[model samples]
Target chain A: MIDLLVISPILVPLLTLIVCLIPRISAKTSDAISLTSAGVLLACVSWLLITVVSHGTLTLRAGGWAPPFGIVLVADTLSALMLWISAFVAFVVLIYGVRSGPDALSPGHLHVLIHGLIHGLMLGVNGSFLTGDLFNLYVWFEVMLISSFILMVREGHHSQLPGGLTYVLLNLLASALFLSGAGLIYGKLGTLNLADMAAKLGALQDPDLVNTSGALIFVAFAAKAALFPFHFWLPASYHRAAPAISALFAGLLTKVGVYALLRLFTLVFTPANGFSTTLILYLSMATMILGVLGAVAQYHIRRLLAFHIISQIGYMTAGLALGGELALTAVIFYVLHHIAVKSTLFLVGGVLEARTGSPDIRHHGGFYQSSPLLALCFLIPAFSLGGIPPLSGFWAKLNLLQAGIETGRWLFIATALIVGILTLFSMIKIWNESFWKAPASDHPRPATNTGGRPFLAMLSLCGLTLVFSLGGAFVFRLAQRAAGELADPSGYLDAVLKGGTL
Target chain B: MNSLLLRIAARYLSWPLLVVSLWLLYRGHNLPGGGFIGGLLAASAFMLYELSGYGRPQRGFFSISPFFFMPVGLGVAVLSALPGLLGGAFMKGLWLPGFELPLLGKVHLGTPLLFDIGVYLTVIGFILLLADTLNDESS
Candidate 1:
């Protein structure tokens, strides 16, 4: 029964998706299936987290088989926390999707793509957390990427056409590179389990093979996370996609890559592979600098947010690069804060676009006057994202800076501070242009309605962001424990060897 | 919009290209070629058809674009790992021992091969899908 909870969050949604595929089901029934599945998943994920906290670590071997044999789903505190947030956000987004009308996409097609994407994404995130295997992580990455592509194209708007092509091509190339890396590793070491591989890798004294294999794996994750050079396709595609769909991507998909980078760097590739930490730290700084610079240049509100996603991801990578117990803990806190804040921002931006009829900030003015409630929702996330005091985002940044100062990485600590300032600037730019100013053009405006169920849902998420600020000590402690666990890889390997005794 | 050379290429290259794609997929596990390249090859086959008859109403436009195939290929590639996940180590190949075939060498068949085949279909399918969209714009 306990093991069932581990798989239920994903399995239930998948089953509902299948049932919804029945062509004869009334639209009402389809909506019911979707809502019920989301509710059930959220409930199960919450329970799983509670159990994990009490029981140390939650492990389930799929179909009751043994190690290196059957697929396994494991949930640490971090995995459990992310699972809950991802599903909860999707539930809210689905509500927005339904309200937008059945014809927001190509009728039945939208439902299919949406359901498939949730299932795949949940599976990918869950697998990333649970699997003690390397190749399995790559497999989940592909699943998430494919599902995201379908969601992107479910709406065939002309603007999306070129970006869609680019997204597909670029992701495909990344998949290929991932495959080549996986293939090389499999050919060399006969086993693909993460814990097992780490043990074997530690035993091998030859530095060259270890470094080569380590770098190969790093390249694969770098491509997926869209670190700096590989990030070009994300903004274009994200800006072009319909808002709700992009919101989901903005929130969950890239985290899979970041999660992988964190899990791998901390656990398997430890004892300092000479260039690995420095390489990640150097890349993280560059990714942060470049990402923020790109965001500053973008005029479209949606595009700016997309660029910010890249830069914020850099912060997480940098924390991981710093490679200390406190730093890893900061990475966990930052991941949660960013997910919550980013999801809220994208959803609110979607609603704003819904009201203003354009994502261009220059075109949007006096929007706040028309929809004060919507403006309120946007403001909470905006200030939170800029690391305003008492907000969850501020703590995330504080921890990262603490990690940097402790590690004596003065440059990154300085970079983090500057990025925070730029983030404030960008947030203010939107506030000044859209919320406080007057409309610039005579474009027929959409009715700025932020009331009723949409209001309740958006309000609930906004309140969560605020509450997270004041009541984050428990999570901060859990994150610190997890990070400390990561900095000491022997604990992870010991857990596996001793049937998760740790 | 039709040209004699385009028709000749469509008529002659389609099946042969398709066969070459399958061959690439079959040898992909131990060789340089795999699903991505194979898919592109098969997509070119359909592009040939669209080229020969720019006016032809094909069965699908948006469905087969590399956009669609890209996702499908990725899904198949990922799913192929299920066996290893359940039975052995991650991505440990599921080898069905080669048996004698009518024309080919002892057929070296496995899940990776099947995954490669799926990749072949998806790449070809998605590429053609993208071409169809571009073709629609031109006309």
Candidate 2:
């Protein structure tokens, strides 16, 4: 029964994808089915979180085969927390989609495609989180890329093709690099199961070969996560996607890359040699500095948020590089906070775009006077993303800063603080241009409707962001617990290797 | 490419090609051949038939929309895992004992075989859909 619960979050959405694809299913029906599936997934993962909290880690082997041979799904605290966050964001995205996405799809057959895309995305995200095998992780990445590729190009906009091309090519290259790295590890250690590899790699005589493979894998993940030098592909591609897609991608996609970094860097490869640690430290500072600079330069709403996503990734990497229980706690908390805050901001962008008929701040104004509620919804997440006090990001940033001080990484600490202030500047730029300034005569101020479905979607997401703020103490404790589990992966290994029946 | 020769060959060759594909599919569980190879073979035969008949091959048995096959195939593939849920796992294969049949010597059935068939249908549907779309795009 527990085994059933562990796999249900992945399986239910997959079943919905298949069901929604059946011919004659209308868009309305597909939407309803997807929403129900998202709701069901939320409930299941919330239960999974509780179970993992109480019972260490839950492992379920597909085809009932034991680990080190067949694929295994392991839901440790980190995986459960990530899954729960993904589910929550997905639920909100579904509501946002109903109001914003109908006209974006290609009408009849494509309706089913949208639901399938979401399901495929969820499957990949959850699979990546829960699977204990490296090869299975690659397969899940492919699933995710395929779904995202379809979604990115589904609207067939002229501007989207270039973005889609760049997105696909870079990701495929990353997959190749990842596959070779997996092959290298398997050749040396004879195991692709993460737990087994973690146990075996340390004992192998060829440390350099293991390090090489680890570097290859790290580069691939960095490219996926869009860290510093590898980040050019992100803003170029993400801004061209549909706003809802941008939200989904912003909220869930790259974070999967960061999650992989957290999982692999801590558990699989210890980074004790300081090779990865030093590299991560330098790259993260560069990423933070460069990303905020880019965000500050952007006048496009989605583009600015896209760059901010890159900057925020820097904070997560800094946490990982700092390498303590507290730092990892910051990593987890920042990830959770970023997912809600970023997605909420993007949804707010969607609402703004709907109201003003432009994504550029230069073309719009006076939202604060017209709809203070939208302004408030936008401001909460914006302030939180900037690491303002009492919001979730402040605590997340504070934890990172404390860890930085302990580790004596003064440079990164300074970079993070400066980035926070710059993020505030960028957010205020949006405020001054879009909400605060009076509307110009050329671009007439549209009547605001706070009672509409779009506003309601924004409100719900705003409420989620507020949860991160109001429940900060509780959330911080949760992050601390999750980070403790991540710091020691023995429980994860034991659950997969010993708890299952062959 | 003599029209008459191509037509003769396509018409005469298609049936045997399909037979071979199905044979490969049936032997897939233990042998090298499987649903993916079998489906490709069937698609090749169908494509051959279409080309030889001037891209106007009429539907002989299945007349539903071509999109029907893709979804149904996926549905079957996912549904084959249902029995595994009963066993407290997913995608775990369950088998029935082989039995002698009237015409065939022996018949074996299992969820894995059902899964293979689903894969086969999906591959066939995928190739056909691609062929149709490309063909539409060209003209």
The candidate scoring highest on lDDT is 2
Model 2 residue B53 CA deviation (Å) reads 3.2
DockQ-based CAPRI category assigned to the predicted complex of candidate 1: incorrect
Model 1, residue A69: displacement in angstroms?
3.9
Screening candidate 1 with a backbone cut-off below 3 angstroms (N, C-alpha, C), the clashing residue pairs are: A74-A130, A132-A194, B64-B125, B64-B129, B65-B126, B65-B129, B65-B130, B66-B126, B66-B127
- Recovered native contacts, candidate 1: 0.00
Task: Tell me how candidate 1 scores on lDDT.
Answer: 0.73
Looking at model 2, give its docking quality level.
medium
- The 10 consecutive residues of candidate 2 chain A with the worst lDDT sum are A98-107
Pairs with steric clashes in candidate 2: none
